[model samples]
Target: MSHVYQELNPGPFERKASMMITTNLSVLINDVLKGAATLLNQNWAITAAVNVFIIFFTVFLYLNTSTTSDQVTIRSASNNAFSGGNTTTLKEIVFHPNYGGLWKDDLALIKLATPANFSEGVKSISIAKSLPKQGTNAVVVGWGPKSYFSTTDGILREAVVPVMNYETCKQKYYPIFLFTDTSFCTAKDNVGPCPHDFGDPLVYKNKVIGIFSGSFDCGSTTYPAVYADVTQYNKWINKVIKS
Candidate 1:
């Protein structure tokens, strides 16, 4: 939906794709009931406390795990950006730990670079091969909650959106892409990133290059904020991938 007169919204960065580990709510509840034993002191208060603890723990574990799907950075373009780097797959995303609804993978080897600005909105990138290998910075082609969830009471969900050069996106997407030095852009060709494909990758160079972070479909393309780009930090990728 690239257009003029309307603000731009160059979604977020791109990268290799990865699957996150999900949780089983039913199994979690069952675990609590199954472990409600052994501590049979007859003390009603103690018994109740024990059960409560188990339930809390199980729910916490289950909830935390739902967002474990690995999100590998994917390469979109096949130009000279990166012609001879590692070709990652969907299975490899699990190697990283999924916690707090954040893809905190290899801080060094893999990373979600600080956000950057493009034009109307912001941008972000996720790193696949750390600095030196590809570069120093990476992308975070993110999706879902623009901000982190304040309450961890439910399952973690992801979002899917588009990305474009901040300035370019602003011209065609929305004005939201114009934020600060910490944002960029991305989205689908017709409808931008949706809620289902949140945190998907936007492949770039030999390794994952950018991230699909944020977006706001406010009927009009004015306020759009997405993940930043990290190609600028390719130096970071080269330094960390080998070590």
Candidate 2:
């Protein structure tokens, strides 16, 4: 199992970036050639050459295959967010704001807070207040890495994006507005949530309220990063817990 986390929509480079393709191709060619040899009674040296070539190709392909990582980074490299002690905390919880925050639970402890307000998707965990923060402006921290397809497994990253008005976000991603309860959306920017930032925190007012879910593939000027509306998911979360 590869450890690198994926973020953002798979761009052209990412789409074509499958490492397994080479392996698959090699296996198929080997099988086909071997089968053909039985029918043709071909020379063994030639078949052996193909097998050697396949091994070389497989090695190269494996090296070249890249896994997409989280784009978030800490503003303060020295600060530790989780355990408290550092003067500045750097990490944040982020929602992919695109891919439905798929790996969220793995990265974050998805807790359903009691005294539940009518809000959706709200969960709470204790993190140090000392770490670097974006202030009232929401911040996200994720365990996914920083580069797109660079490592089979990567580290977590953190970033921040402004939350747009709900009406404005509705105009941006209407279908999501209709179906999924995203509290708000962000304008299109390199910072907009892309792929792997799942279970990242969407912090506002010193609270980790949002989880990176998605607006992964679907994007436009209006439709940028979309997230799971923690305020809206309150009831749903409670259901899971109470059950």
Candidate 3:
């Protein structure tokens, strides 16, 4: 069976829409999985880094050829002011070997040059050990632009979205794009991450479960937002942090 899949780009900061028609589901699935295995085993050298305390944020932050480790900086605890928080430079970036073009396993760890001093506002978050169940309420946070027409105001924002059924989500993007086990979807509530919010964390019960990957219309009521399943990479994360 062949399916036609189409995605729309909200603006310059969002992914461009592409039309795809596929008949071989098994082959596509196999290729994506294999590609992840090969890519995850390799590491790219980018001088950019962020604080380990920030979790997998750098994974989504925009990076270009000119970006360097010392050039990357992270701030924590400031809710309204982007400049009003504890700041630190990044020392190293350890990306998930499995991260690939489809955004599966889209996560990374950063080593801060200095330890972050925890305070009433700045703190660390726990990674989810288990996958979140469908219908569970979760929070997604970011400082990105709220809409395509608006620019980022440097204020941190958050929204509550319910977890969508994995199988149902699979059907929604089937043939055009196959989501692996390392990915999940959240309900579209008209208010979620927009462009420049790729690396934001999806929080469930105070634990990080998902990393914002991508969405067609930001938070389209018709298309649910996709996320990288953080729980699926717990072992890899532990190994890298320990090593």
Candidate 4:
């Protein structure tokens, strides 16, 4: 049996443009990357020197006041799940606003009111710095509905999924607008994040490489589910943690 850390029932809410993407923050980093590229094009040494300065001087943080169906609560990994585990309150939640703050930039960094303590069943997982390659096997756990017709489960559930090619995901979600440059989709159906699974971490090699963003339907093999690529937001996360 896998360990379940957090559990949440976000309840019914709007789906369209509700998935988190982190486009707003990505734009800022893109600008930095662009500036670095320009300098590199001129002279690699100068660019490298400036890169270190920019990284050291940058302190990116933003406030979000929009309503969201997602919530973060830390709990224990006992068989009883959240029932016996301690619950942690959220101190702050950060996300980027883009595309009218509708769908793009869907990822959020949640700060707990109190720092967690590591114990026998409580530990922290690493977030991947590099993107997982296509066809990589990953695991996702959440307290979402099992299917479209099913109600949200109180306990956490997990599913194994394969990382699909970004190009293939773009093709499948073309008309619907998904799988952005900073997003990717998993393969198969009824085996990944379902409704209300937003913000769940997609684990690869015991590290989180993706975040549950959205899906057209629960357990749709064709569309699978979209997740915000964690590696794309590495800078954003690093800034938050360092601050």
Candidate 5:
């Protein structure tokens, strides 16, 4: 399989309008590739909702807010299978007001159509209040393919990746690409998320600090995997959940 990282154009990072798309993952990916960012304003919603038991491609980080029935979901387990877990429909989606272009503020809040009942297997995860220190070990969880050439195995997996310094990561993507302060990098290694791993969470000390955004080449040592730093958007998250 060929993994391509498309370069995004810099535009006004302002909240302009909102649009709704289907809940189909493949369709969403295609739209995103076709520059759906231009149509998606500050908040975008999906036509169909997702189950709370499994994570979908557009959501990550389940927040336990008492004000709303909608909760964020991450991409995990089989994308089309729900053999052993419960499922729920998504009610609404709220993307960051400043989200612009691909991998920039690549964060969103999913409101389930129905509230999820907390149980032993289903629970809310807290967002990171601060960024993790460089070299800290963080776990990336998803059901994406293990390698670029392999297909998705439908089994949820986790890999520990060390956080890379922003300066060091900046140098790696210098000239070709530039990451904003809202983003962070994980050291390049054989272990990292591949295609279909978008929206997966990167957790440090049980707090979600990152959301898998993009990678030049899956698991490429030359290019570290990038994530949207959740610490930079805690206030935005709270505001969305409460609104």
Candidate 6:
């Protein structure tokens, strides 16, 4: 909903139209559920089957929705941002063995003590198995500072960044640190990730393909921001998921 509002910058009539559509959809779904419930008393067998089917269907829908939102909110180890405090805890951080100098293999799988509750606002995001073709448009979201020297007020901002070809990125970043083939780049003059956006997911078509690594300098129009390619670490990610 927020994404639509921000991306479209909808007018009053458009907003009203959207609200009507949403309200109608909600009413239709509720009516269906209520009708299903009405079957409970008359036919126990049918009701049992209906209940089972609904459970499974809802689960599948949630998995897909949550998968596209894997990086919902960022929280500190201690829940200083909330009054009730977050129940989730970081269980482990698995970094690539070769992750060092120039932040190569700058990928890590964070395990939670308990899985996050997948609902209307919180969910998981799917990770991409294949790299995005060069020039693909990707969405970058973060709660980072607006600029290199600014401070974050905890507002989430998003940008559409275009993927750059490797040779071009390599040429631009040469002499600093050659980006491993396992890394990728994105940039547009004054339109890219900032310093505090490190570790944020870079999503393409609702799948996370890379993570913000670093840039020659934040907000650099000349130097594109680099990201650790998630496609190259699928095996490691799967291993961690299984573990």
Q: Could you say which candidate leads in TM-score?
A: 3
| lDDT, each prediction | 0.27, 0.31, 0.50, 0.47, 0.51, 0.48
Global lDDT of model 2:
0.31
TM-scores vs. true structure, each candidate: 0.31, 0.40, 0.69, 0.65, 0.67, 0.64
Candidate 1 total steric clashes = 134
Candidate 3 ranges with C-alpha deviation above 4 Å: 1-68
Q: After superposition, how far is residue 216 of candidate 5 from its true place, in Å?
A: 0.6
Error of model 6, residue 9, in angstroms: 8.3
Per-residue lDDT over 90-127 for candidate 4, one digit per residue giving the tens place of the 0 to 100 score: 35544543422323455545444555444433455556
Best by lDDT: 5
In model 3, residue pairs whose N, Cα or C atoms come closer than 3 Å (at least 3 residues apart or on different chains), thus clashing, are 40-97, 40-98, 47-69, 48-69
Model 4 lDDT, full chain set: 0.47
lDDT of 3 at 156: 49
Clash count (model 3, backbone only): 4
In model 6, how large is the Cα lDDT of residue 221?
48
Predictions ranked by TM-score, top down? Answer: 3, 5, 4, 6, 2, 1
The count of backbone overlaps in candidate 6 is: 6
Q: Worst 10-residue stretch by lDDT in candidate 1?
A: 37-46
lDDT of 6 by residue, 1-243 (tens): 111112235441111111111001000021122101000011110111122233334434644654321222223211112212133333344556676545567655544445544332233455688877788888765544556676543334456778876667877877777467788888766566664456555677767777777776654548888877777777876665665
Candidate 5, poorest ten consecutive residues by summed lDDT? 33-42
Worst 10 residues of 3 by lDDT: 19-28
